[model samples]
Target chain A: MDKVENVRLVEMGQSNFIKPYRILFKQNKKDRIWDGIKVHDSVSVLIYNVTRKKIIVVKQFRPVVYVCNTTNNVQEGISIDTNKNPGTKGITYELCAGIIDKDKSDAEIVKDEILEECGYDVPIENIEKITKFKSSVGIAGCTQTLFYAEVTDDMKKTEGGGREEEGELIDVYEIPADECLKFAMDESYDKPVGMIFGLHWFHMYKLK
Target chain B: MDKVENVRLVEMGQSNFIKPYRILFKQNKKDRIWDGIKVHDSVSVLIYNVTRKKIIVVKQFRPVVYVCNTTNNVQEGISIDTNKNPGTKGITYELCAGIIDKDKSDAEIVKDEILEECGYDVPIENIEKITKFKSSVGIAGCTQTLFYAEVTDDMKKTEGGGREEEGELIDVYEIPADECLKFAMDESYDKPVGMIFGLHWFHMYKLK
Candidate 1:
């Protein structure tokens, strides 16, 4: 553990892609407040290919993971050579998800997400709510709802890899049902909690 | 589903507690990007009272949940009243958690959080990592790690209800292990995915 000091609000900025705000709040049993950020509410979907007995997954480069990887490298005294996209380590295996600030139902929003991100036209009725939760309770307090949807080959409409106009370069993958848990749990897998939770949900509730 | 138009970065602001950052991203089949916010990363812990056969939980007021309740009111054509904290409906039942940016090891930070927020002093060696994932992949992109720990009566150090100086008015609840699953699964339980996941993990891995 490192020495922790008090935190407080210092500054904030906004961009078309995202907004960055800072907070100063206390730390280390101190009376002062330290700084942190707060983002938006979002949703993540677990899409099961019931017909194929497989799981639909997505992989994409994430700027946050990239920067975090880069930061870790710098901390470990690794030499930084590539000035261009040095944080290329951001690619992540994640569930289909999107923010929830729109004026629409969670099912409707996830239905569109399924179509655009995975190229499946899952109906709103097919999507079941697994649970609604706050993603990161410690730093930012935003709500995220997890959804479950079972789809078959009949639901496939397009080669879903996300829209190019949105600057998204998503690669979609489908893992066999028997291998889904192992694949998601592999130590080498670069995955998020939502993805792993989704896989676990499939194993516990859907695998019967 | 209602019509969803493109979103643009509108405004950003900072308060003593949280910072609000907005983003404009594409949504629906439309070519329009939607507006949303981005917060920060966090952590949550599921503490098990091994001797007592119970799970530690926390309850507190959350402005975000409160606002969501209030916004639902507006959508339903309910007139807004009570200018002085009208969004009082922001209470949440959640696991014990905190931020990771404090320079402490995940075990150390969560260890302190468990003690501070829930009034338990479980040692670091007893804490186990369940999994790490992004809280809101669609928005904040910050990571949250879930941890599990088991303790006994000897671990009790204080009447855990969160520290007052930090402005945390937390109510600690310990549900018997026999009732943990149902309590966590109750539709009325205002819990996060991590908590439910923890409970599920407890059921699948720890209980038997």
Candidate 2:
């Protein structure tokens, strides 16, 4: 029960566009107890530009909000009235991020994500591993690798618009450092990680 | 398109612990769009016991490491692993949060979460909405509600434990404000949001 033991995958499935695998392991903790657990892995990125003093972000429709609002009978979740379907498309504002593809370095994956999501080519100066976090535990064992990047104002403009994907139609926007924090703290923004971390780094390096 | 509209949930189901639903909505943006999204309408509590100058955090296991770890052969968009069983049991660190039940108010939910997750009691002051964030976009549209709680040192004890429903194995740990940031940034801590915002708010309020 003292040495490293072997691990095995138990149940594996992909549903709702998420690939999740459960594992069973014999842990040599104290007396070689049999244990099993599930985990989900994903990736995220934070794009920062030094020149324009702005960060790249995107807005998209999120179906979950629509569901939450409707099921809870909450009038404020997301406006998804059948009569107003087109306009009330799920709106989610987020940072430039994507699942890590095989054969690509974290930098490469994030770089590609920057282009696909925000159309930016940022030199991955430093891959500051922010935190590997779990988005939800009750259902999916999904965890994400969060990283930060450095860019400039010219880089922001040159990157241009995002490449529209099959089911995704996104709009790229840039907000100043101060405003980024303001937006992140604002409830209307919906998603806040990218802006939260971007503003933190800005204050840590620039303001300080 | 300029006015707000209502939506209805046609069906709801649970997929691997996450609740998914189909919705029918009407809007003026384009046309009718049937959306299916995963809804995990949960609450995250950032507990700060001002009297103790400490915060509560929990650590558990995560399984997504295999996929996230590039060294593993989970590339080419291969969602399943047949060679090795990647088990999902690792010590993860995170904040005290629980899914919001249908009948509880936000304040009531947080109060209940505090006791169930960490075995503490505090008078509900006010629930400050941090932001509703989409943990991942590539998958279902699941969003999380983040909140903060102010408590006193008298509210906690040395051996705080989780509920029987939580498998009765969670070990609640109190972290001082100064060191919470470092722990939150560490990869070993399974959950990062509670620590992240906990430290952020501590520094922001302390400086003021």
Candidate 3:
């Protein structure tokens, strides 16, 4: 599913997603102006298909990760050649996640994300909260509430590939529990904290 | 140590930390441009004092977290009043961490952060590397390598309160292992995924 090409940086005005803000804080010794971005808090879920005995994961291309890997100079941008920085490098393994930009509750958004990204229609009653934490403490400081749930094959309604309209080319994967842990430990794979925490949580609480 | 006052947002031209960029990518179906930022990757360490039987945690004020709590508007910023949002609200419990800006190995940087932020003089041989993962996948996608180290009271080299010249007033706290887990679950405390993952890792591997 890696058909991405001609990745070039474009100078833009105020971003719809990341808004830079500098806040002045008077410290005890010296006054400091801290630079941070205002970003949306989000919800993520770690899913286990009980019938298949596999964990559900969504894989997608993250432009930010790609840019970070290819771009050496931060002040100025670079033209990312497909030969050098392939779309495969930008691909990241993540728990089914959605940013909190909608007006619905966090759990509702999680449900919507699962159905849209992974083709699973998980019942809201089956989801369990696994605690809330900020993934990026220094930059965004956005609270991401993590959840866990178990599903069956019957929960699958369609062949999900995320929302094509929003440029999401997600690939849904059903990996066995052990394989999932191995994948997380594999340094070759690009993964996020939610996935790491989810695997550890499942290992500690779910695995017998 | 919560004497922060007159927290107001200032409009700046370009950010020294976060530089926003829009990348145009040639997709399979429709051409889409993704917006992301160029940010710095960092290192964090979870420390356990073997002699004291306590887990060392650094607590400090995070401007981003504080601003997120105080501001309601995203486009136009709001003034953060101490009456409405206390400096304690901005405080986050983090592993001894530092952004990757110095010209050194990540492990060496971790050692410096431990000594500077938590005042622990850990032997380089004693420090062990945990798995690496991106905490903020959508936004920064910065890879943070987690490390684990065991120290003792005798290793306390100085009263670590972070770098005061940089306006960092960090407080180091050593909580019992069980209490650390309890604090992680407590919803009132602001924390990050590194702390959560580290706690679970300790609970699974270190705790007897």
Candidate 4:
């Protein structure tokens, strides 16, 4: 089997929150038909509060899931809501996550996010890695790092203050462990990595 | 506490697989201002092979993860590659996955993908869900459904014909079970959901 090679980035450009990069490639097999391809790397996180018997989840807006859900509804014989306008379905729920900033350790960025997004101060020792995974492939390129920590109920209430940026209204919730698992299984939870790690932990530690 | 009002999708549109949807808002105490928001939703899958002790994974040209990795290298004093161009990174490994086609159960869609992408005919009963989680928020609106299945080693030989329309080039491999967890943990693995499920199953059934 031929080994898959990694192409290096040659050019890059970024705006406020969006960044684009170029990659170098070479043809491998005689199939020269498959010469080279470019790809993207992304960062994501998962936070679990074991002591509180809950997980820190955020409810916000999501545009893609909304479209898929709407399209599914239309195909399933469910009536579409005609009064609503475009981009309204972007709200979403997910674990505290952000792209990995350049030059920052995964732990450092995740630690900061815990405070900014969930208002909790998580010690590095307590932030155990659940796993690293990919988020999507169609267009956006991101890989997520899922982590867990045991936050007490007291911590949930005292450090519950969250970030409020322009057009970003985040609501932090201390979801019950069982309910969190149910939500993860049902795909009702907002983010994909959150549900993956939540259910993973449940399967590993909770489910007998 | 005021009840969290149910959000409704108002309008939606899709262009070249990049979809953006609009949502309607029911006002509550949380906010007295905005009447609606825009959102997006997407789907992903985690394909596992229990019989072969390997899991299906994909390595693609990810413009995002690649860029992020390059940025990290620049910060670390590593020289950037100057020979590459900007394009989608196409890597190979994994079972079958795609954005949910409108109007189908995620499971049903994934089951079909297993046949289309992996060339396996496993019963749906074997398709165990690991979790549903989100990928990113600051940029894209999407969620993923991670899943696992037990497949025979011979199943690995099955050809996963690529989806040309979608530009998906798929290949099937039956990696060793013990190495799967380690492979999944590597930075290159990127997608952790399938690994998470693979590791969870390993700990529960194999390693335990």
For B4-62, candidate 4 gives per-residue lDDT tens digits of 11111111122233322223232222321221112233334555566655556544444
Q: Choose the strongest candidate by DockQ.
A: 3
User: What's each prediction's TM-score?
Assistant: 0.74, 0.72, 0.95, 0.63
Question: Per-residue lDDT for B20-130 in model 2, tens only?
Answer: 333333232323333333445667777777776777776543333322332343323244332333323334566777766668787788888787767677777745655
lDDT tens digits, residues B1-208, model 3? 6667877787755677667778778866458777777768888898999897899989888888877766657443567678867788888888888889989998899889999989988888878998888757777777888989898899999999998877778999876886766877877878887788888788877866
User: Native-vs-model 1 lDDT?
Assistant: 0.64
- By DockQ, is 2 or 4 better? 4
Worst 10 residues of 2 chain A by lDDT: A1-10
Q: TM-score of the B chain in model 4?
A: 0.62
Off by over 4 Å in 4: A1-51, A63-68, A71-91, A102-105, A153-161, A178-180, A202-208, B1-64, B71-93, B100-112, B121-158, B161-166, B177-182, B186-188, B192-195, B198-208
Q: Model 3 over residues A1-208: C-alpha lDDT tens digits?
A: 6777877787866566667777776866457887777778888999999888899999888878877767666433567888877788888988988889899988788888889999989998888889998757677777889989888999999888888877789999777886766777787888986688788788767865
Q: What DockQ was computed for model 2?
A: 0.15
| Preferred candidate (TM-score higher): 1 or 3 | 3
True contacts kept of each: 0.13, 0.18, 0.78, 0.25
In model 3 chain B, where is the ten-residue run with the lowest total lDDT? B69-78
